[model samples]
Target: MKDSFVAEDLMDLALANLAWFDGEDAGDDSGLGCNRDYRDLRGKTWADVRRVLECERRLVADFRAGEWVPDEPGDGPEVEDLELGVASVVTALSALGCIPFTSCNGRAFGGEHDADALIVGFYARPKHWRKLVDLGRGSRTELQVWDGALWLQARTTEDMLRWAERAVERAGPSASHPSLM
Candidate 1:
């Protein structure tokens, strides 16, 4: 059985993951004060990361608002500033109350998968559990269980986009902000 979790829990988890990098060094010069390893985030807080990444504030707000319009271009996080292809998937998952900790656009160093695949690591709420199962079953990609989270692998950027679309559809209308209920 899938464990139940609330949107607040996911928000806290995302915040914690961003906070975890506050103390580390860049390790390499990838220009964002952080290397490809996600260290030395320019500013101290997740808020800084969001700003530097040019993340659309409304998307983050939508996570809590529990309402999102998928594939609306500017409605989601800015992909150009994100780690390539996984941004859409991550944004979709976040809208569905999932906390993504890691992701890759399937570059040469992307672990396990080929250089063309896209992957994301996240924690999902129980309410969205069935959708995950359905995605894994219907897609040409792979969704695997990890120690404390889940990993999704898609063969191409379009595949990930399709997965995101399906997820939002399966979830139907988003619920209200967690605090409102």
Candidate 2:
């Protein structure tokens, strides 16, 4: 039988995976220093949004490219550790501004997925969960802003990618925020 997992359990597992990243040490004040908010249908400034998206892109690229392989010589965690690592990767990606709505479906309460796993990995507190959920809500065109909540529609992946790219462009750094790195 499959082990039933609660949202909180998944969140805890995800957070544990990101423990090495020191997201808590980032000192980002917007609920999720790295986690973003996407409630306004009009969207946020590009500069602010790109930093988060860049983080997402890097994480996804790493995962898809198989660059996160555990160290050899039995230094890696066991099977359970691998599971948690996957969960953490998912959480971190979501926290850094990718969408995971495809995975949650109706399991979420009030059509809201538990983004606590993602948010906690990016920020220091749990309250940022709402912002992460809002970001996911805005990622899809199928989901519309009606009345004051998200409504489902026939959206496509291209639309979401376009939106994410636009958000990144707007959020990308300007001449003012020079990168020391």
Deviation from native of the Cα of residue 18 in model 2, angstroms: 36
lDDT of 1 by residue, 1-181 (tens): 1222122323333222222111232223343212243322121222222332234334444544657544543233335355545665665555554555567767522333334557887655545555566655445556655554667877665566567555544544443221101
| Global lDDT of each candidate | 0.48, 0.30
TM-score per model over all chains: 0.47, 0.29
- The TM-score that candidate 2 achieves is 0.29
Best by lDDT: 1
Q: Write the per-residue lDDT of candidate 2 for residues 1-181, one digit (tens) a residue.
A: 1122123322433332221212333333343322353111111233433444455455445644777554543233212121211223223333334322212112111223333221112222233333333434434323222222222221232233333453333334452231211
lDDT of 2: 0.30
| Candidate 1, position 71, lDDT | 56
TM-score, cand. 1 vs. native: 0.47
